[model samples]
Target: MMQHCNKMLHHYIQQSHSNVTIKEIIPGKLQGRIASPTSKSYAQRALAAALLVPESAHPAGWSELRRMGLCNDTSAALDAIQRLGASVRYGDNRDTYYIEGGFLRQAPAELHIGESGLSARLFTPIAAQSPTPITITGHGSILRRPVAASMVAPLRRLGATVTDGANGCLPLTVSGPLRGGTVEVDGSLSSQFITGLLMASPLSEAETRLLVRQPRSLPYLAMTLEVLRTFGIEVTHAPDYTEFVIPGRQQYRPTVCSIEGDWSGASCLLVGGAIASELRGAGIIVENLNPRSLQADRAIITALERAGAILASSGHLWTVGRPATLRSFEFDATDCPDLFPALVALAAFCSGTTVLRGTNRLTHKESDRAATLATEFAKLGVEIDLSTPDTMAIRGISTSDGSLTVRDPRLDSHNDHRIAMATAVAALRADRPVTITHAEAVEKSYPHFWDDLDTLYTA
Candidate 1:
């Protein structure tokens, strides 16, 4: 299985060099079940925590991780950890990772995070724990996003010396024996750096007190806290997540854990199921998702419910089908901004106008998500209004007759994974085939996305 997974990863890497054109869907209902991909969100946090564990705590100081994600972002996290001096090896199944933590003894001169924004932010503070100077860099869209306020400022306040690349972005040279104390962090841009701080603070000689302002994506913070707990680290926080108190000089216990299934990736599949389900039949069943996950994107269920999509769940299985009539629904996605792309696709098939708030959070993502979604979906005749600063109003193309005509069959993914999946899902109900450039962007979070979409048709 490990060899198979590696081959699959190699296959996607090769496909990324060319375009993947999705053929038009004929009049047919989607069927079959696909397991949700492992949650990279959980996997990354776990991997970072594993790097801090003492070898004395467990045999050879190894932390076992199961159900690891096969996405580029998680891959970046793995690579970042290895560069920082932790040893990693895969089990026979390739689904389990045995990480021997000991990064403090030796620090790499450079850490490249690839295109993962989360890795760039989550590793900055973690990397700052080293007394030696370490340069953090990445490729693709991540280099273009601003990080000064979210990452550099806070690390500097904690006694880390940080040099910005050019315009306060990546390629940051950071050095520190990070001291724990009271520090203020602006949380409006992202919560990833805050997670980094929480994980790294335990190594400081003094206790850490974080004063976070304008915190967004609180659910993701909860997820970080949960991972910290699993590794036997303690963190106390304010009820509203405005402040956090972490004890210093704490040790991370090596433990075996399993990552949850990702709702972020499953969202596109669920939207596809809601859009393509027959009037009377079993809809698409997505297995392995936790209904009560702390991940912010779990709000997809609420949006589906608001849109009047039929949903039923038993244990880890969720089935989504189109209702007798789909209605445009209002959603506030400030905390779960990643859901915007999938929700946009779901709204495209609903009647009337759907208003989604949290446009302010979309600017620093893999792409300018709000602008990209509007631009690409318009090619399918979907009307999206972005004139309002904090809101996006999408006027749905009435699919009363079961299909909508694609205004232009060609589109672009803007090298963003969510955008790629969203466009592919929207095309399921299109009158014509849609061909998307840079479609391989799905490898970022969901490496098997195209394959899973195919299962719906072939089944």
Candidate 2:
């Protein structure tokens, strides 16, 4: 099985048939709109929460999730939930996942999370609820990222003995019927661990008060809270997002829920549209995004506006037109670290220098995002200075003539979905066709990304 999974990753990497070579984005009107994929983050969170619901709450309504993207991450989340003893089925529409709630009878030998960092971290505490010792592991790039002291420390605090395979990474062994009580989790590393704790706390033998010191990605935590509330699990947190108090032994009411369009994935499309609009004098329309979503990447609109793109939203459809003159802007990405790559792509065509903060958060991703973005964009002649660890100053060049100053360069995606997508978007204004290797990495988040990019073109 391990060999087979490795073969699959190799197949995805060597899929040059899927490599996208962009010479230019034709100057034309974008015809049909791209309905964004379902939020993988939301789907995973919902599935985790659903696993904690009692068996009596059978036949919960989960809508539009099973069909939205089917990326490896979301698929891993589904598989993880199943291992935890939830019976999941697809509706006739083939989009909604109907999950029958229950707890595990016996722990699986190993929970394969499949390169999804969220699934590995978020499900660890969930799996710890079992009396049986379980080994949590994953495949691909996730193996290199740390499980962090934040995760292991708190599990230990909750009465679980946690052990990691050297240097605090994957293949972690956790044993617990976690008797939750007041625990302090250092949230500066990543908020997903806290989210895991929150989702698993309600099932603990005692009330859980989670005190977080300096939480990052606050919006993602807010997103977790919103999903918890939808399933009738309440978590009370402070205004600054420092503390969360969860009442123990609370039941997760079986929910009838549909996932909203993903702002994270949609932000890539939205930025692509903004850059494409510059070439074609067209107002690109993107569907299925809520203007009021709590997602941090939803701030892409604000970034566009700052860069002088004409932008507006009517319900779910958002329109962005290129500005006559693109200007450099400053953005603090502390809460929205995922947007760094897309923002880097957008800033490449903006004039002068664009400064993006929160570079500190990029190190622990699938790849070191800051270094990867800087390396890949430099191939396209964009100068990125990361002298200060916490900030990145991108010196943008004028591509107003719809031609990149740099010659055609072969770019590598470093096996990151966002890097591949961001580089593709940046190629829109390039003087020559850009060739990208490992382009199929988008399957981790957006499986049909190439299909969506193909649709944006009109003869």
Candidate 3:
């Protein structure tokens, strides 16, 4: 696996297939329309299916195993499926995945998460379900990434033994009976850890209860619930995620499922459209997003509107074009840390400055997102101050022209996909070429990100 890591990491960059980096972005106010890629948030649902469902009849696997969208991030999820003893073969005419399920046996010797935090964090509790020991590892910026400490204590209580990197971090090893029971978790951190446990428990012998304390991003939990139901697993949650009941021995039904397009990645396009809408006479149009989606990143619409972008929706199609004038709007990113980069890009167009709170949670992301945002923006003539560990204040550049060279040539990915894409977007606004050293990190979610963005809007 380590060899695969070394090969994959070097393969993309050295071979110039890390995908294309934007040489320069002349922001003349983009006057075109574009559609975002399939949702990774939805794609992982298929992975969970492949893990728990079997392809046979007479109570074979999860019933909803059908054709689904294949995106870069979801491909990582499918890879995790392959490692867990499941057979994944795609249809020649269709990207359908035929998963032979029931892989609750011993885990692989070592589980490598690549550069995907979603795959890393979500797969942790799933790995704990096994009686045999599993070693979880990743490459790129993963070693420095912070997974919520909330994941540790519960698996311990469940009788699933675990260990972390130097400090509640990765390269974790866990051996478990995974005895299910009530445990406390902090919602203030990423909701993924708790979501992992919720999804893992039905396969356990004992029923489980999860009590969330800080619960910052609750919407993601809701999405997890939706997936659980879709996969034929049953979990009941009280109003606020205060309590969750995951029944044991629930049979997973096999059926096909479709993944949604990502609202998170679409944010960049929306911001670009909003910034240029006034000059172009129309904004951006996005499809397949649930107006009531559990993804906190869906809140981009609110942020765009607050910043004075005119937003109107027809059916599931959402449009964010030109705004009369973009203004600074303060955002509290306590719940959706993933939105920080797109929000920062959006805030740059505002007058005055924008301050985002809850930046303390960024250390675990692809880059130390707060620091990364500050550093990248500074190179473009935007200044950011980290007053609190979790808060950032950015002064906007009313006007920026010409190339803005990134100060540090060898920038770290922090193994977070959003950071990689965020830096690329930042480059699109500059005059000179914005070359990202390890740009392949974008594959953790949006594989065609640069391809799509470059089509209508050139950098």
Candidate 4:
């Protein structure tokens, strides 16, 4: 059998050359059942944890992960672990991964994380656990994002030597055997590096105390802690998530972990269902989601409820039904910024105006998400006002017939995954077909997005 890592790399190369043109959506034409993609967020974290497992914990030294998401981000995580001295094998089905966990006896010269932001941040600290000098770098939009304050400074405070590229961007060279102690990190930007610290601290020589300032995305921290627990590592944090306490000199227990479905990708399908389902037609059914998942994007259910989309659940399966009309709703996305693109697409089909808060969290994503959302949505005839730095007000154009009048225009994804998915969902109500450039951007987190969307069309 071909190695899963090589297969994933091949998929990435193929996706780089693909594009998609979404035709006009016919009302009552979309109805189907599809499983949500595995959560890349969880999969990547789990992969990182797997690398720290000592051979003594599991005689086989292998951590078996089932139902792992093979998206580009997760692929980067897998590749990083292998380069760092782990062995990976996939089941015939390709969804089960057996990773022999232990760092390589020799350090790699450099770690290339592709365009995954999470990989760069999460692995930087994990990489710092080693004493050798290693350079962490990425390509495309990630090279343009600022990581100095969020990643570099925190590592420095923890006793690691980090050198950043121009403008505090990627190509970061770091050397460390990170010393553990009380350190303050600005959490206003992202929760990813904080997670990295939490994962790395246990291996340090002394206990670690994290003083987090203005922490955002608290749910992700919870998820990180949960992943740590699964790997037999312990972390304690305050109720408000302002501080974290990790005992050092701890070793990871290699074990099996199952990745959960991705709500971030499923949100688009649910919104598409709400827009395409007729009054009496059966809506879309998305399976494999856990209602109690700590993943932040699960808040998509709240937005759908506020928009008056018909929702029902039966165990792991949730179905979205059509409402007589989608009502404009307000949502605070400060803690769940990934939902912004899907929420924007939903807002374009709701009557009146929909206000979404937390535009401030959008600047450093795969694209400048706030500006990208505004620019692309405008081509589809939706007006998004970003006059306020922290808020986005969307003026929707739904008619009395519950249909949207959108133009047939060319859109660009800015090589951002969420932006590509958002535009495709918004195009469902267009009067004419919409062509999206860099449509393959969805491969970052949901490689099967277009295929899944097609299933609904053909159903």
Candidate 5:
């Protein structure tokens, strides 16, 4: 089984060698309707939940989720599941994945998470449920990230022997059948830690009481609960999202679940529409966008409105157009840090200076996002100042008439997907064609991002 997982890992490695470069985007009126991809965030969560419950017991249609195309992160979780004794098979549909779970027996020697923050963080605690010693590791940008003592501290408190690697990154070995107990998790760094514990708590030997401190990304926790409920797992928590209670020895009943559209990825498309609408009279209509999605990036709408973009929504369909006048606005992105890039892109087109708060969380992502955004946008002649540790001010360059000061510049993605997508969106209003290197990085979340952008532009 480990050998099979190694093969899968090699396949992914071979696939990543292909690189793509984006030529300068034509500034114009963009028009078209495109549905965002199923949320990898949601899909990864559901896949984790499914691993805890066997297929025979799950609800009908649950197998359909297996048929969907797997993202790099989702693929990692699935491969890890197989290594942990579960059998994954394809249905007659050939696309649907049917996982016969509950077989967690011989824990593999190692589990590899490839550039998936969610997979690495969320799967670690869950994998500890097996008494066998297993090491958790990952690839690329994930290696540079600090696993931090906080991530393993809660598990250690719960009776798991965890040893971090020399660099304190991956290859952390855990020996446990995590015996749940009262534990405190520092939630400031990431909510993924809390999410991992919540997913695995029900299977613990004792009821679990998890107290979280200063939890950010609360929406992601809400989404975790939603997915847990879908799989017949119950957890009690406060409205403030500070604490959670889970019954011991609880069973997870699997059910059919579908991954929803991703607002994080859609924010890029919407911003592109807003910028393009300014150039061409045509507006962009985005489909599969859930107005009530638990994603933090849904706040993009607020940022757009604040920047004076005209938005109209009916059900799941949303349209964005340039406002008669765009102005700088102040936004606090502390709760939704993923919106920083898209907000920055929109801010570049506005007439005045825009202030975006919540720079603290940017350093731990795929890249030093805050620094990367500032450096990359500077090439386009936009000035971004990180005046304080947690605030970024974007001084928009525009003529007195409020038209964007577009210029021909080449930007680098720094191997960050959001940065690549954000740079492309900002290009919509550029004075000349903008070239973005390492544009293929967008595949980390949105594989069809360039395709969708081309669709909207050519339509």
Candidate 6:
């Protein structure tokens, strides 16, 4: 039988002509304005909904998917949907995309997740809900990424039988009628598992109550609650998220939900401004942002504030402006791991030294992010020393030459959306252009990321 498209895959390159790279300089004064992209978290939730709701599962219904913002991660989420069962068609008008969603008649013998850690983790539970056996796998560097066996043990206990090549590694096989009851997962590993179980719980024979072993990322669970509400799946939970009560049966309403713009993606834009002080002062504004969001990346504002960046949040709109003197400060990234890259960029431009903690979660991303950041930043005369496995100290430096140098122009994102966006932002501030080898990796989160950057970078 054919395996999931995780190992030994192929992508036929379409664009034959090469692109150009230049020594670009982000003026010391650059503007701090760019529309935030769509939340990949929202996109993943929507894909799961489209698959679960029998009525909306079809290629033609995909046009119902609209853009709240630029979505590279959502693009990968849609790709996984299509690869699994649904067929999606983009309308000719360039404004509409169609989803042919429906439960797989026979479990797709193999479910391939192309470089999406969220897709791989969340879909495992969803696939286990299906009638037949399904094997899940992911491409690129995810093969070696760790999975919390502690997280999977519950799903196995509740019914769904599973198998994998290594210690809870990818190529996860699930066959089940998830006998959902009580499940416990560690929030520190990855919240996507919690989201997967939550998505699969409504259809389970029994209600599922989750007990977070050590709650780390509460914001992610909050985002899950918001998405579940959007689908009309009412979930009742205690304030502490220590418990969850999911009704056995659910009716998913076809939603005209407008996904909120991503604070995660916007963090990079804000940090870019913090690095290039020229963009501050006036005429740089970001609108339509929620001051109160369940996204941990919202802490980017706090990090910027700690580093001497100006921030003003008015209801749904927020703005980040440059400060006269940026200072170095230590930060704990336990909750907001995704912001590490953006924070690193800002940290590099600050005076003195900044030490960022919580590197444990950095391994399973699109690439070995800590090493990637250190290696790339090294080319620009910035000093990043990883003394411990879980801590990194960055010594800031001032850019003397107009072009901030990057040694490896051939750097690849290894298909991590955050990496792609972060590298693009670094390019803006660097004296030299950054030609990310796998530039297409942005599809995992913000598909139109380059387009959005083009608007501001060329302005």
lDDT of each: 0.86, 0.79, 0.69, 0.84, 0.78, 0.68
TM-score of 2: 0.92
Cα lDDT tens digits, model 5, 305-412, are 888788899998999887666789999998888889999988887877899998998888999999999888887778999977799999987655443454437677
Could you give candidate 2's per-residue lDDT for residues 328-398 as a string of tens digits? 99999999999999999888878899999999999989899999999999988899999986999999885
Clashing pairs in 5: 24-434, 29-280, 58-254, 62-256, 66-97, 67-95, 67-96, 67-97, 406-431
lDDT winner = 1
- Residue 96 lDDT (model 6): 49
On TM-score, the stronger of 4 and 6 is: 4
Q: Give me the candidate number with maximum TM-score.
A: 1
The candidate with the higher lDDT, 1 or 6, is 1
Instruction: Report the C-alpha lDDT of model 6 over 1-459, residue by residue, as the tens digit.
Output: 212212112122334464311122232344546667767777678777766655442333332556534354455567666655666566576534555555564467888776667877778888887678888887666667765354468878878887765876787788787877887777766777888888878878777788876676778889888888876687888788777888776755545555667788777777766665454464245555567778888898888889988777667666666676679999989778888888888887778899999887787777778888887677655689898768989887665643456665555565566766676666666664445556666665666655555555433
lDDT of 6: 0.68
- TM-score comparison, 3 vs 4, better candidate: 4
Q: Model 1 Cα displacement at 225 (Å)?
A: 0.4
Give the per-residue Cα lDDT of candidate 5 at 455.
Answer: 68
lDDT for predicted candidate 4 compared with the true structure: 0.84
Top-down TM-score ranking? 1, 4, 2, 5, 3, 6
lDDT of each residue in 1-459, candidate 4, tens digit only: 211121111111223234343222322345879999999999999998888887666567789899997998899999999998788899888999998777755589899999988898899998887788889988888889986457877788888988878888988888888989899988998998898899999999999999999999999999999999988998888999999999999988888888999998798988887876556578989999999999999999999999999999988899997787788999999999999999998998888899999999999998899999999899888999999769999998856655455554777888888988888776766766566777678888999987787677631
Candidate 1 residue lDDT tens string, 1-459: 111121112122224335453323333456778999999999999999998897677677899999996799999999898888788999999999999998765789999999888888888898898899999999888889886456777888888999888887889988897998899998987898889899999988899999999998999999999999999999999999999999999999888999999999999999988888676568889999998899999999999999999999998899998787789899999999999999999998888999999999999888999999999999988999999989999998865576767888877889989999888788767776667777678889999887787777631
Residue 9's lDDT in candidate 6: 22
lDDT of 3 by residue, 221-291 (tens): 88888888877789888887888989887766666776666789888777777664444376557676667
How far off is residue 154 in model 4, in Å?
Answer: 2.0
Better of 1 and 3 by TM-score: 1
Q: Over 4 Å off in model 4, which ranges?
A: 1-28
Off by over 4 Å in 5: 1-24, 55-69, 90-95, 103-106, 278-282, 400-408
